[model samples]
Target: MTYDISLDKKKAILLVVGCILLVVLSFFAGLFLGAMIQQPETVTAAPNSEKPKKASAGAPAVLAKKLPAKPKVRLPVKPKVKLPAKPRVKLPVIAKKPAPTTPVATKVTSAAAPAPALPAAPKAKPEPYPYSIRLASFNQFKFVLTGLSQYRQKGMSPYFAKVNLGEKGVWWRLFTGYYPSRKAAQAAVTEHNLKGVQVIKTAYANLAGIFSSKNELNDIFKRLDSQGYSPYIIKDAENHLRLFTGAFITKKGVQDQNQDLKADGIDSKVVER
Candidate 1:
């Protein structure tokens, strides 16, 4: 052991050792780079191996077992049923009663008998006084009025009549008392001592006017005469000259004549005799 090495040989050995170390390190680095690149491929290939696959008809039993099994689903169903039919029903009928009838009575009729006749009554007798005494006649109604007043003073009710004597003209004849006979009438005139009075048979005569004016009297008298009326003059109690027209047998006849006079615009009233 006591060998002594030279400096140039030591340096030559150290160079050889560093060259070896460099070559080894380079080889290890190349190995590590190859491992890293191959590790990513292996990781990608591992996931592909874990993925599911459909089983084929011709596949092996080992592959069918490796596939996942599917779950089974079931649905519910309804059942059919049958029911019985309903029964039929019938009702009873009712009867009605009849109403009662009433009996009617018949009436009998006969002809009525005629009534008996009654007896006729007797006629009444006429009045007996039919005569009148004609007192003094006057041409003027005023004179007749004065005469009537004198006779009334002597307690005699003297009434006058108008007479148309044709050519002799109109005269106012004063009269008093009704007598049954001319003899009785004469006897009454004598008893009264009536001057210039005569017994005469007289009937009912109408006295139609009692006018104050002689002109009016003449005018009415002429009018009545022209109209087929026999008008004459008489005197009333008030000394008014009145006109007389007709001599009728009945007072009814006088009334009819008065109606005619009224129709001719001469108003007349009934004076009963």
Candidate 2:
């Protein structure tokens, strides 16, 4: 049987086929885009997988083979530059100090000189006069002066000394002459008919003179010493210096010294200590 299709029916069948083909083409294009999107993710996720299950079977074999594998990125390598070596500096060597050597002692056979002899000791000074007569003691100096003046007027050369009796206060002691013994003092008191006077044993020396200037006393002392006389000094309470010579122990010895001093033009008195 011969089928006769008109031109309009033929055109209508061609439009329907084109529409179906477009739908199928659209579906395949969607699948191909989905596969392309998932392929990189799968490769990134499991790069070592033998088979990528996510690959679409509908994908063309020629496109798969033509796709380039991920190219390995070679980072630029830094070349090692050889730097010049630093010059070695030679350190200066320090010289060590030599140790000190001990000196050797040498002995000599010659005789050694003897040491010098020491100076001889000086002679001891003689003792002072050991006896004097203390006539009376007064508490007030004026009274003692009055007594001294009265005694002087009566042909007696009297002297006074100031003595501190500590808790008893200071006293002015009146004396007439230096005596070698208490008996000699008593004899003098009796000869003078002195009353209320007692003999006291004490030390005294012959007084040459009282001088205000120590220089004058020293001059006189030197003169006496040069003349072979032993002279000494005593500072009185009045700040005056009294020069004395020869501390005699006997009345004869005192008289002899007085005579000798007189011969030498030195005036002295045997006043009380």
Candidate 3:
């Protein structure tokens, strides 16, 4: 017991050494096993860097490519046109003026004309006086005095007395110194175209317009004065036979008075004064 108990230090030393070697061996084996359990990884490049190749210049011959076909179209043709013909126009011609002419004269004859004559003178007759008287009238017998008065106032008086026809109721009258003699009274009555100039005398006076021959009314009175009849003259409106007594107008008045007077066997004449 004692003997082993005192075992050798050297061996102990060797055992310690062997234990360190076993630890180191275990670390190295562990490191190699961890490496062996892991696989080895291979590395590769990017896929973009590996591309396919393009066609080469030395490929097989191919045929030329043909063009596409186009659609067919036709163009239209145009027709030709003709124009109308124009007429030709002509101009008018002008005219010329003519010349002037002269005038002519003719001849005449004188034997065909007539002649002229002269004038004559006139002749004359002898002239006389123009005188007149009214003879008598047949109405207005009642106014004999009145008539006599009017005639006397006008320078005329009754040459013969007034005579009355009693049955006829009329008067006869005469103015004074109107005649020269009986011939003058007769001539005056005939000239005046009067009727019933019974007896003529230088007694009666003249009135105007009984004679157209002369202006001798006063001249006749003067002639009667020279013949010695003192007859008075008058200018009275009532000296007519109507205002006197006998009332004689025409020849018939005197004739009727004469016949009446004759029937009574009494005669009276209407003598012109």
Write down the lDDT that model 3 would get: 0.44
Ranking by lDDT: 2, 1, 3
Q: Write the per-residue lDDT of candidate 1 for residues 192-211, one digit (tens) a residue.
A: 88777778766665666557
Q: Which candidate has the highest lDDT of all?
A: 2
Note each model's CA RMSD in angstroms: 29.7, 21.4, 41.2
lDDT of 3 at 182: 56
TM agreement with the true structure for every prediction: 0.34, 0.32, 0.19
**Residue 102, candidate 2: C-alpha displacement in angstroms:** 55
Q: What tens digits encode model 2's per-residue C-alpha lDDT throughout 182-203?
A: 7777888889998888776545
lDDT of 3 at 193: 56
Rank candidates by TM-score, best first: 1, 2, 3
Question: lDDT of all the models against the reference?
Answer: 0.67, 0.68, 0.44
lDDT of 1: 0.67
